[model samples]
Target: MNHARKVHIALNVTDVNRSVEFYRTAFGVEPVKWKPGYAKFDITEPPLNLTLNHQANIEGKGALNHLGIEVSSTAEVLAAKQRLREAGLEVIDEMNVDCCFALQDKIWITDPDGYRWEIFMVKVQDTQPDLTVPQGQHLQACCRQ
Candidate 1:
């Protein structure tokens, strides 16, 4: 896949204009193409080609757990969080969270029509499991797996 320059994602949205605005703020760039019921974004930093398709039925989102952009460092994650907040977008953040044997920092935002997105960075690749917690300690949603 070295020849592939970017990954493409087509999302079904209830309102194209609204979604376009959200993405415009999220990506900090205007769409390369835009029109009624459709918009396209060529995101350079994350190497993503994202599109919005107006759909009457956005309920069946098709096995999509969530969408994410992975960054290189915790500072990058915090920078993304700050940018998102300054844009007046509601952001939920997790810092130094241990999940799947990795310590990660992440910021989450939900787009119009209810799609979740995350900008994240893994601080540590692998971490030893903690033995202090009692058995059956509830797991955070990200750590469920």
Candidate 2:
């Protein structure tokens, strides 16, 4: 079928219930479908089809550095921050921070599985010099984290 205007990501989580709760809070919406070991969230704002699959013995980082939604305006970012806060999740804010070659206003939320989700708005866009990483350092360090 036509899948335009949407992005799909399936994540393997150790706990289905916990992931469902986390995503519900993060997206400000419940899963459109939920089963014993699977949950799917169809988010409209950013048009995402995110699914969580219950899996044991997850190896490696499993969770990546982070996932983010680029909002249209700062107002939208603030609204998202408010919604996540109202859901009783600890939200961290990064205002006017230069990251990823752009000036951004953003907030961060961590799921129980240690996956980080960022809600941000691009305030200014410009070419930024390439950043070099030091030995034994991770890419996250240069990401304005």
Candidate 1, residues 46-74, lDDT tens digits: the string is 89867676665558565343566767667
Q: After superposition, how far is residue 7 of candidate 1 from its true place, in Å?
A: 6.7
CA deviation > 4 Å runs, candidate 2: 1-59, 127-141
Which residue pairs in candidate 2 collide? none
Which runs in model 1 stand beyond 4 Å of their true positions? Answer: 1-61, 128-145
**What C-alpha lDDT do the candidate models reach, one value each?**
0.65, 0.66
Clashing pairs in 1: none
